[model samples]
Target: MTQSPYVLVLFYSRHGSVSEMAKHIARGINKVNGMEAMIRQVPDVSDTTKMASPALPENGSPYCTLEELAGCSGLAIGSPSYFGSMAAPLKHFIDQTSTLWMTGQLIDKPACGFTSASTMHGGQEQCIHSMMTPLLHHGMLWLGLPYKNKELISTQSGGTPYGASHLANSTYEISLTSDEKVLCEAQGKRLAETALKLKK
Candidate 1:
């Protein structure tokens, strides 16, 4: 039997906001008949002055492996914003994927990014760009939500043409706006469709 095409949804969530966005993206991926969504999370990084994470995650999704990145047909990477950038744990994980980079394992695979921030102007777009850099180095095809998605064009909240985002608010409630949800789904669909076309 032929294998179902899978999109790997990899993210790092400090306060659960980014993880929620990943689920929304997965919903969109599943909407496509021929695609599968594999959701994974990265371990938290400690300072050299502190301890690394335990071998198994104490709670949420399983830790991601380089093999997941190598085998995925498409990718959606997300993280909580850290000073207008992706958080260190996710970046640390990506930094270890040099073997995949050398072999061009991710070349031409469709990829997109999302982020969550604590405030309205928390540099969501910058986080998206930062997440895309390693994917670009691996030669993955970048996917973004198109203006055709009505929510993207009109969203006053966390939706962006770059990718989906959530304004976690001052209290860090982590609720996704309606537009944010739509754009996450749109982004997922876009990446899956692009991967299918590239596979052909």
Candidate 2:
């Protein structure tokens, strides 16, 4: 029998807000029986240094690779919003995945995105959709939260059709609202189940 595929949860977090959302998604991915979740983070980008990054991260999740993107059954990408767009560091990482896109390795795989911002009106949907563009170009199946997720429609905090999101205040105190958490878990579980079905 073909082995179940792993759903890779890739993201970049500056203030740990987006990292919190990634964890919620991983929690949902873990609910599936056969599928697995792998969490990874990308290194920061800098103008001064194009030489290379350290072999190991100082702390937090390890660096991601194109191999991980190619091997995974599905992808969950997250980023913090920077003026209605994904942060520069996350964009830098995604830009490097063109090699996988060129090989069609990500084709037919299911993918989704999420984001966190420092305000209720901080362009959550825009940020998530921003990350979706490259994945769509890679020919991956895009997964979105359905309206049936009641928390999505009723959320006074942060939740949307694009994906999952959280609202952070000035202090960057990011908490996944109940609605945000539910939607994130739902997104992860949905991706895992879909990956299994596709594998079959």
Best by TM-score: 1
Model 2 stretches astray by more than 4 angstroms: 1-4, 48-53
Clashes of 2: 0
lDDT of 2 by residue, 59-174 (tens): 77888888877899999999988899998878887888878877899899999999888788888888988998988999999999999899987888878888988887663787
lDDT of 1 by residue, 118-138 (tens): 888888999999999989999
Clashes of each: 0, 0
Instruction: Give lDDT: candidate 2, residue 81.
Output: 85
What TM-score would every model get versus the actual structure?
A: 0.95, 0.93
